[model samples]
Target: MTATKLKPTLGTLHLWGLAVGLVISGEYFGWSYGWGTAGTLGFLVSTLLVAVMYTCFIFSYTELTTAIPHAGGPFAYSLRAFGPTGATVAGLATLIEFVFAPPAIAMAIGAYLNVQFPSLSPNVAAVGAYFVFMALNILGVSIAATFELVVTVLAVLELLVFMGVVAPGFSFSRFALGGWAGSDTFSPAAISGIFAAIPFAIWFFLAIEGAAMAAEEAKDPKRTIPRAYIAGILTLVVLALGVMMFAGGVGDWRALSNINDPLPQAMKTVVGDNSAWMHMLVWIGLFGLVASFHGIILGYSRQFFALARAGFLPPALAKLSRFQTPHRAIIAGGVVGIAAVLSDGAVNLQGMGLTAAMITMSVFGAIVMYIMSMLSLFKLRRSEPQLERTYRAPGYPLIPGIALALALVCLVAMVWFNPTITVIFVVLMVLGAVFSKLVRGRGAIDPQLATEV
Candidate 1:
């Protein structure tokens, strides 16, 4: 049977804003900054390479975005490039990255705020942030996209201004600080210990492709989604490279050695006791990351909605609002969020259910999805030679091949670097596979129910 066509509804600016704001400055960079600062100069250099690798994989995603330009984003691309089962697997992997990221970002809001008001309970901050984000998301995506655009602009402005302020003040000598073969952390088992830290370095850009998942809702998705995906990735390149190179130059490794904070430590040195202005800057940057997470939840909900509608997940999740919004899917995403908040004192999930845990599962999922996407990019080029592409992936075979290689390395590194989370990720993948079989055997995820969602 010929597949039904579904287009996404986001515009260029909105899609780009959603991609850039949430992915570049969101929790990944915020958290990675802290982790990077804790390591030595050697580790910092390697971390920068990871940032480079992220851009490489992004080239692959960008190609897919331009080619498919449909609602399911990666899933849809894979479906067209591969098949249904492949699409579901890709969707699951993409789902892993974000399903927990929003909650984690909300928790980070509490943590970042805690730096100022140590006594403010994380529970209150998380719950408050979650509800606000939820409201923005449910109000229809355009509102959230606009908010993200504003936040992304502010964030990019802040980071750029901060870098400019520090640029002329930089000293190249400070980056010569020492470290071993493994990352900055030293022990008999240093190789794995340092590899374990790779994710923290790469995490900054984890949510970059999120907008693609919501491509169905993107206005003129073919045009909008591709631009958004590229712009979002470029945002990361500017932000990550800007911060890394800028930090290494202007900030002394001595004061920054014990601290994992890029901006705080830099502010302390440069601003030097200008407590008022530094606090203002830090909070703005921090909150910007927190606020942008609305994009992540937005993407995840749509993916689940697509899955449900396509007969993979529970059909009830495919319900739409009067205005055609996937109200049920959005709410279902939020419900898990409420549970996550209530689970372990609000912030505990950031540790237990986050990057080293569920979030890293997302990283693994992204790798799997990315590799498939690379293959799909290649296949589509051959399968539909006549299909139009706005932004063809530069270097074609070489670009896609490198992206696939980088994806494999990162996955291997993730496993070697983070065995504990690695095991959990494999277990989850197995479960997803098993569940896929179970759902298929059940005959259309619930055949008794009407197909009227």
Candidate 2:
């Protein structure tokens, strides 16, 4: 398979937009589910822990991104450190994380739209979103990146607006009510609840590292990636904690815990149901979901194109269009996401909706990818000591060590709490291994493509 190159059109601002836009949706909706499992206070502890993990992980992960500057991101890092098998595992995990995440964000987009148009079906709206964003991604990287920047800025401003509008109503008394896992004092149950809420807390900063996939398209990537990643994580951490705290304090936190539109509900308590601010939360808030949905489309397509170029997936998917974009790969991922949206009611787990289940599954892939990425960092540090690294992870081994240790704890907690999802994830990994083995047996592997970066 011939290696196709992505155009160098993204700069630090575009990279920052992609990094934050790819995850800003988490601040909009899914993290509220953590409140259901761990109440406000318990979930707060969970969020803090996960935030620390992401901060350290991004710091360490930047070393690999700058040295390699590959569109394959984690797959390329692992390939350089390990071999084809490691690359295959990382590729599959990344595919799952990027592909599954869009469908969940799409559903959130649809739900927000449905609030305005009561007659619209959310599933239909979700599939429509897949069609529209995939087209935008296929047009060109610069256009897509520009759109991502505008929407991300709008999304970030809306969150700030939300906080300002609701601040007058925020009270410590309401926030502390049932804060410790529904108990006045912390206990073993509260500890268990914090562990169980790990996946939800992780939802906050899940895809910030996806910007690494755009490094090949970056001008002077080594300088840009670190700036984008560090700034993006810091921005997300502040917004996430602020949004969660204010949302919880404005009303009965339990009331906002189980729903998709927690921000709107939280705003209702402060401004009433018919207030302009409440409407703004539902309307402008769509930008957050749109930003994430559009950015992930770009992310997943690049991963698909990179995998296909490296002979892990069908080479046909690596073909560039007249516009010099991975049109086929973009469409392929959209098809998978649309199919998931169509099968919404058919596959339900633990009495949760398809969106929640998809979030858990995506988090499963993200955790696996994180583990492989950190391990790759350590291996490359020892094996290729001469590799050009424009940015080195601060605190060396200790920072990444904390990230890896926290990721392992979260993975164990997720597997214990979501046994069915764990089985499904394992089956997917096994299938990926089998496919890689068969491709190798047929002599379809391309060593040149693996080292293209």
Which candidate has the highest lDDT of all? 2
Clashing pairs in 2: none
lDDT of 1 by residue, 287-360 (tens): 46654567777778778776666666766777766545677777777777666656643333224443234345
Candidate 2: regions farther than 4 A off: 1-3, 182-185
Q: Against the true structure, whose TM-score is highest?
A: 2
Give the alpha carbon lDDT tens digit for every residue of 212-328 in model 2: 999989999999999999999999999999999999999899998877788998999989989988898899999999999999999999998888888787778889988889999
TM-score of 1: 0.84
Report every candidate's CA lDDT: 0.65, 0.91
- What candidate 1 gets wrong by more than 4 Å, as runs, is 1-9, 26-38, 165-170, 179-194, 248-262, 272-274, 341-359, 443-453
In terms of lDDT, the poorest run of 10 residues in model 2 is 439-448
Deviation (Å) of 66 in candidate 1 = 2.5
